[model samples]
Target: EDQVTQSPEALRLQEGESSSLNCSYTVSGLRGLFWYRQDPGKGPEFLFTLYSAGEEKEKERLKATLTKKESFLHITAPKPEDSATYLCAVQAVRVQGAQKLVFGQGTRLTINP
Candidate 1:
């Protein structure tokens, strides 16, 4: 069974504080891992996609890294605008021509000034 787990269900940080969020997953025949940021009442915005261990991607104040069993989102000098729910998802090889995406519960991050 493929599964994803995010740690620290919720986090609070002062403006400019730096932190890292974790996403651990287990899947057979891995295809790709993805990252997203979702604001309140809005759909998730795509952040990055990782296909192999040691792969990484970055955008603005956020950087994502992937390993065999987990991924990390590192935020540097976060601002209030960065407050949102960060999501992690994985895609496994198709089973019966149907692709499935398994997502973690997400880490709700709050940045205060």
Candidate 2:
């Protein structure tokens, strides 16, 4: 079965604090590892697309990396606006050449100023 799981259902960080969220997944054949940030009541915004182990992607204050069985979303020097639900989704090779992504429950993060 293909599934994705996230840890620490929620996290609280002070302005400038750093932390990491974990995402574990099991899939038949991994086509891509995706990271997204979602604000309340809004759709997820794409962050990274990792296709192989040891690969890393980064934005202004966010970094994402993937491995064979897991992925990590690392936030550095976070700001108040950076607070959101960090969602990790996995896309695998599916029938009919469709890439179906299974998303994790997400790690809700809060940053206080």
Candidate 3:
């Protein structure tokens, strides 16, 4: 079974604080791993897509790295506006030509000024 688990179900940080969130996953025939940020009452916004180990992507204050079994989202000097639920999802190799996405519960991050 394919599954994703994100650590530190919730986090609180002061403005300018830096931290890393973890996303661990187990899957068969991996295809790609994805990251997203979702604000309250809003849909998730795409962040990164990693296809293989050693792959990385960055945007603004966030950087995402992927490995065979897990991925990390590193935030540097986060601001209050960065507060949101960060999501991790994975797509396994197509089954009967159909692709499915498995998602983690997400890490809810709160940044305070």
In TM-score terms, which candidate is top? 3
> Which parts of model 3 have CA positions greater than 4 angstroms off?
none
User: What is candidate 2's TM-score against the reference?
Assistant: 0.95
Better of 1 and 2 by lDDT: 1
- For residues 1-113, write the lDDT of model 1, one tens digit per residue: 99999988999999999999999999997899999999999999999999999999999999999999999999999999999999999999876767778999999999999
How many clashing residue pairs are found in candidate 2?
A: 0
Please list all clashing residue pairs in model 2, or write none if there are none: none
TM-score of each: 0.96, 0.95, 0.97
- Report RMSD (Å) for each prediction in the order shown: 1.0, 1.0, 0.8
lDDT string for model 2 (8-103, tens) is 899999999999999999999898999988999999999899999999999999999888999999999999999899999999877786677899
The alpha-carbon deviation from the true structure for residue 27 of candidate 1, after best TM-score superposition, in angstroms, is 0.2
Per-residue CA lDDT of candidate 3, range 1-113, in tens? 99999998999999999999999999997899999999999999999999999999999999999999999999999999999999999999975867778999999999999
Candidate 1: deviation at residue 76, Å? Answer: 0.5
Residue 7 in candidate 3, Cα distance off native in Å = 0.6
Model 2 residue runs over 4 Å out of place are 95-97
Once model 2 is optimally superposed onto the true structure by TM-score, how far is the C-alpha of residue 20 displaced, in angstroms?
A: 0.2
Q: Is candidate 1 or candidate 3 better by TM-score?
A: 3
